[model samples]
Target: MGKLTATSAKALTAPGRYSDGDGLELLIGRTGAKSWVVRVQKDGKRRDIGAGSFKKVSLAEARVKAVKIRSQIEAGIDPVAERRKARGIPSFREAAALVHAEQKKGWKNGKHTDQWINTLTAYAFPAFGDVSVAGIDAAAVRDVLAAIWLTKPETARRLRQRIRTVIDWSVGKGYREASLAWPVIDKALPKQRAKVKPHPSLPYSELLGFLFKLREKETMGRLALEALILTACRSAEVRGALWPEIDLEAKLWRIPAGRMKGGVDHTIPLCDASVAHFERMKAHKRENNDLVFPGTSKGKSLSDMTLTKLIRDMHAADLKAGGPGFMDPVQNKIATAHGFRSTFADWINEQTSFPREIREAALAHVNQNKVEAAYSRTAYLDKRRPMMEAWAAYCGGSTGGNVVQLVNKSA
Candidate 1:
């Protein structure tokens, strides 16, 4: 029998180590916290390995573990390595990384790939990042969400989904028990007061003057920004523009599935104004470089900050001249590059007679309504042509007055 009994192990509360014989020892911390430890010798090296807490792991349980450790050592196994390898549970943070690395390649949006992990890192990591995934109960999950559930409803909802995704991934790996108790946790979390925040957008009425100002000092950055506005495409789409994608003859810019935000092929109709920007870029195209708007780096495109800084400078200049400086009239915030898409959308809804399908096509927005998306297979390249030309016309001084004249290819 071991030197210490269950009653004796609990009674020894003083700060000291007491041997239970056969390598097993009871350790009492300075704070009187008691735990079990056992020493083992293998390969001429001896080390102490923890069995568990004295209170939770009774004297009998500690003796049993000590016997198992000795048996493993006798069998020429590194008990330390075996114990580490058999770490009872994986952490939530570790599970998230495994899930991200495995699934990120399928996500087409570059921003989305980063945001997937970023949200977890920002919120979930603080609460139970290092805690064992298997140990996480509904209370822990509820506490992680309670702080933001009511204040930032949409973000919290997305965070909840992402948390559940990691938990579900852990469950598949056998790191968690059953599925997450989200249904039970949901009742504990406060009901979110849904608040939707849209991108700050310049008013459509002020777009004409904004476009005119944008064209005043013509640089590669301005040209790129104009292309983004005229085409109503996203920032990365315009910045990463390739020469081969542009077709002056067909009046189309074909963006392949890999390059598009949605993993679907998109075709953009080049209006009279958009073609002019491409024509200007044609003169500056380096023999080795294929980027339509190449940055200072040999083959690299301009950074997003380059365009952002350009807008900021223009805003400062506009404010200096006693104007609103391209402010989003509603939010009273400066207009953003992405906000130009919102501006395009607002103008299309208010001023234009173009059908909803055609407008969505112009912006390359995937319809959330599955039924509508099923019926709207046609890209309406022909219809968007006139609509874009008119948008260009409206963006210009009047009806197509400021647009660059079409160059005759016959020459």
Candidate 2:
């Protein structure tokens, strides 16, 4: 018998794991999403199998499911795999969900992980989702690819790869006999050329001018955007920044390994200009919240669209004021917040005398070179300090309308 009653389960709103007897658990996420899991030891190996979402499965149902799971474990059968066997064969959607549940632990970026399944949900699911894994073949695969092949090339390409992952997983699980003729699908679909379109970013000469205009707005979004530009960090990093991650006395921002795009802990050497933004944020910090850029809600961070909307508004204002908006001359497009990183990179590559690695380190870019990465254990902190300082100084000084072109030179 379980310790949790329906009344107790419904009343639980706190974000943490709650245990019932017989190894059954009720998980509450930070966002208040609730789900159930049953822990069982099979062959001396422990496993936590998801019973169902709390919304879909009541406390009574979860207890029943937990009992079923434990009963199956006692029969020396794998509950999850046996459930699939009991169903005879999984649908493509079921197999995809199974693969995603197993694979998501290795994927660091939540956005990318969600995108992996979302693309399938959008394109592939409509056609083959309900089809049995055994029924999915070249024609079914080719049909899905053909619909979006020419229209959405990049999405189609990723969709193809994701489809193959699901089908390959099914084959490994013995649901299918062999691999689908991917080469056959390739022949059936039109060839797609990989296109490398660089993100639209400010001209190195115009970045300082753009920053000048950006500083006029003191909203949380703009302040965060300013910090993003000054520090050369990603939008997500700046938005999700917490008070604990920043140290004003030390003038450093330490992003934990899990939050980083590269899955490595990164310490940013803060400049005076970047530090000023944090100081302003600290002045108005909420008593119970730690977010450096908290959204309207107490604990939630700013939405992704907040920064993008700010860019659009500024561009519109500039046009109204008879000035060219913050446009990238090279790309002939309005710049994005993410594009600021590219501007920083272009400035370093085109104008500074810093060693290549120092620039890479400032941006927290993981070196792809295997031999160098194996030996380059140093974080290059001292080298990056001066480079970031120079970058901050370089941008802060340009508070004018005149475009001052910086040339390639040693500082």
Candidate 3:
């Protein structure tokens, strides 16, 4: 065809699409809405670029716009993206929210979804939120991430990843070209010390003493720490624990997949010591809330730093008494509550004869081998009980009398 005539274009009352050659078409909506679109192949992928509606742009005007778009495509430029740039695309925060909304379904839960958006708001947005996603470069990303790189490495790492995701999404949406920022930012950041890096874990020999010191102070954070150490669960799982997830009759703490790091529901076979600790917490439980260890703010869970501060205060107290305090032997750093998981794992590896898989399962670690994971459906709850009991005994100290008996389960 030699292109569409204005009379023919106006006369066409077709309910479907009518081509005007050179990859241009007039689309008639089911509701009788008439619009123009161009189908162009770029980088071997066909993309439809929308032109103005037929009511607004005449057939001649549509042809003019389509010809310009085709020229841009021939020059290896994406006209749709250029138009978005001309119109001033969304800022980083706006784009991040779009990306966040798009990726929410794949995330483990709503809390993670909130964290994803909140972290960007708190850290990334303050610096680049107002800037267009297309305008963000490696220097901006590095500056933002480097501020917390050494101070808060974990948060900084997550922020970097999220920022990259937003930028990549913007490119996919044709808001920008493929970003050069990713490779540049990756290379610009400082390398973490791989040699000395390990979660600061107290030596197993000192764990008993640490527990004794922890027991001397009575607080919800202290109890939460105890629960974490005894059950070998994550701080989040321990802090977010609700009464519904616990079964005193069965001595199990069933952590839903939403709270677990592995995105799988985990069942912790509670040892006697952990059960006793929970019973103590129940006496002080807020009647209105379900949290096992609710914070000072009614229904809210304890902050992550609450547990950290408890450990730090204990270490300072020990030092005032002229002791080395609870220090990680390898890194010479003060032990963190998280490091207790490592301590638990070490104790299992060194002090017991349990198979590696059972220990891994207790820690809620997903198997690296996909095939084995697919076939291994068991939680090994039975095998883990004795091991946890043994751990509880060790944390209770060898002296035995120091282990606080919070409840009389037999009664």
Candidate 4:
């Protein structure tokens, strides 16, 4: 027969604890609201369970709740856990949003965030977006990825990784406690090993012929192609090259962090031939655009696929004319646009006695060892100066002398 008075409710607060008759406690809050709770001793150990609010739940109703909580104690069941189980499960979208927000800060760029959402929307959301997070299992994830496993193996892998990340986040945030092991449960969608396809490249003998033909058919596109071969740089790197990035007087091209694959600034030592080519390009430059090789339109750089398409057309024409087309030595098939890099690598290995490390550095490959790479930070621009000069001579069939040192006037 415990009564909670308005005065007592007003005095009680979050920091204070009080008890009513029959071992049931009436915790009065600072807002003058009261909550009924029951405290019991089971096996000489004290345990507490919240009964209900004083207004919504009458004193009699709270007594019933307290009695039910006592019964649960008698059965060795936690009443708090039972209340949680009674609540409706959260939808998958709700849990996923929580996970996404938690890990958004760790992402490096907006692109990474877009990828996260795109993967979920394309795979996870269609199946489980409306379903409860607690209801999702390993099988649901497996079905989504397995649908695209053979047709789109790389994309499937990304989807699996994204889903695993979301599930891991959900587990950490106490959303769902299911120990469902995704991607592994269905071994059919095992991570596919990336096959290293050789870059399409023309042999040294055919390379001169190819360049000669390109010179005869000299368009803006052909000039750009010549620049790509002479520099031995990636198509994107060459196409995206701005006039501002090139230092003609210094014979240097500085590729900024955003343009480079490793997200680090790189400096390329331009040979006399490359500088001459840039000088030629200056005569045809657009008034408003600063692009070293601007598109036929204006402002926009050449499309990434343009070079590849050009190479394909060149290969077809060569084949039709009974000339040696862009053929893979190993596969006996037409070489790809990207294969030029492999051709360059092969030529470097066979014709020159240059160190493999120097060639690799020229190709802008990242060194694996942190310590060794740090010590070798000069990028060997001086060493590569000769190599690049030799490469240009090899490509141009020029009987030029070896690279000479150009002393910096400031130095």
Which digits, one per residue and each the tens of the lDDT, describe model 4 over residues 254-353?
9998998887788899998888888877765788898877766668777656677677778888889997687764334566555677777766765666
Tell me how many clashing residue pairs each candidate has. 0, 0, 0, 4
What does candidate 2's lDDT look like per residue over 314-365, in tens digits? 9989999999899864335789999999999877865666777888888889
- Ranking of predictions according to lDDT: 2, 3, 1, 4
1-411 per-residue lDDT for model 1 (tens digits): 778887787888889999999999998976688878888888898767778877689888889999998998889975655753587566778878989898776554466678889989999999988766665667777888888988877678668877877887888887653565565677787755435566677877788788778877656777788888989998889889898988988889999888888878899999987887677667767778889877877788878887888888888998899987988643446888899999988677655667878998988888899998888799999999998998888787222234343232100
**Model 2: how far residue 331 lies from native, Å:** 2.8
For candidate 3, lDDT tens digit of each residue in 140-234? Answer: 78999888877787687668767877887888887765554454565677866565366888867688889888877567788788888888888
Lowest summed lDDT across 10 adjacent residues in model 1 is found at 402-411
Q: Candidate 4, overall lDDT?
A: 0.71
Sort order, TM-score high to low = 3, 1, 2, 4
Model 1, stretches more than 4 Å misplaced?
1-195, 397-411
Which has the better lDDT: candidate 1, or candidate 3? 3
Please list the residue runs of candidate 2 whose C-alpha ends up more than 4 Å from where it truly belongs after superposition. Answer: 1-195, 397-411
The window of 10 residues in a row where model 2 has the poorest summed lDDT is 402-411
Clashes of 1: 0
Residue-level lDDT for 289 in candidate 2: 90
TM-score of each: 0.50, 0.50, 0.51, 0.49
